[model samples]
Target: MNPAQSTQPTQSTQEKQYFDLHTTGIGYLNRIREVSPKKGNPFLACNIAALSGAADDVVYTRFDCRVSGKEAEALVRQYEDAVKQDQKVLISFKIGDLWADTFTYTKGDKTGQTGVSLKARLLFISWIKVNGQLVYKAEKAERPQLEQDPSGQASQGGQDDQAEATSSEDSPAPAAEASSSPKEAPRQSAQIALPETVQLSKDAPDFQERKAALKQQGYRFDGQAKVWRLPTDAAKSAIEAQHQANAQDWARSAQATA
Candidate 1:
């Protein structure tokens, strides 16, 4: 391996693990090379090859299958409908999982040929996660070897193209808000009454903490303008409660206070 070369994927330090079958170590995939005469004369033939993770164990009754034309489009519609209606559904493939990720295969008389022209049935079961959390897990049966089409293609049935937003956890979270105290500017709002010399200025210690405390109590700090505004009745009540508590404690005898 080149010293600088990386074995990990570019976006994350977390490694992706594949299926590991004992002995042969076939990984997580098994292939079906031949198509069988089925009960239905469909445009496409799909098979259910393997199930992975916790989701694959259950049997589903309302699965859909499509022939020759486009398995992904038809399957996605079925999957979406089932999910929306809260039904169980599985996708089958016209070819194996490996073939779905590849563009071309040379099988039988079509050796060395590109694209899917054969009447082969394949299946793949897959799970997908966003930022290490499962978003959708599914199975697909499709012929992935087709000429690039004018319409963009969805991934093979169970294959998921997780959005990058979902992978945010795998990457460093946005740098935490700067810890240095935020500078306070002179108050500019005419509505706020303040003494001329008591003008709020920048360089206050723990400004962020104070602001955060106020914010937690439903206050909004216009730091640039050096004004704090109450956002809700809760905030007004909280501020009044603090003052009342202080006054009540002050009323206690000096000896008792001391």
Candidate 2:
């Protein structure tokens, strides 16, 4: 036997592991432009005002995203005219690899103050509604398929039921709920629901780190429900993988102590 060769560590062929955090929601698209950087090729960029919280008290989280996918770039370009004309270009968006970029505000009342902007790559546009009119919807083939859990329910970190319950809550309220005065109903509803969500547990290992990561990725906390929520679209697999890894680490730690 070659003792020296046997002493060397074996190189396993396992694929490199990477963590992906994606943000999915309905948002108003804005600031569509082509960015030319000195070091890299020019790319399309845009801003999205993502809606969150209750229908009555919706909050907006702005994402300065680089349009990454070809389909997304094309879609954003198509709506440039509408956006330039000041029409509301609302879309169901999927943003990937979200992070926060801090900068000193150079103008406005908060000049010289540090401001944090959310940045990401715009990966997909599931659908678009311009001025309350449906303009585009991705075909079924283009949509991602959600994995089914052992319970036969679409698994989103056990938040499928919670998502369904609160999905409509994130959208802008209808005319009736928006005003005290009774308003005639439109022929068709214009309300758009938020994306399906996955909940983060408080008991998870490295809970704060996970929470901070999710916050950077544009996930919101449902104070009323006492859970952190993230969209369950393209992020489902990533979310499940993260929690599974957390579980394994916790089990190994417990075993080591035992």
- Of the candidates shown, which would achieve the greatest lDDT relative to the real structure? 2
What C-alpha lDDT do the candidate models reach, one value each?
Answer: 0.30, 0.62
User: Which 10-residue window of candidate 2 scores lowest in summed lDDT?
Assistant: 184-193
TM-score of 1: 0.16
- What's the lDDT of the predicted structure labeled candidate 2? 0.62
Q: List the residue pairs that clash in candidate 2.
A: none
Candidate 1: misplaced stretches above 4 Å?
1-207, 221-228, 254-258
The lowest-lDDT stretch of 10 consecutive residues in candidate 1 is 21-30
lDDT, model 1: 0.30
Error of 2 at 185 (Å): 24
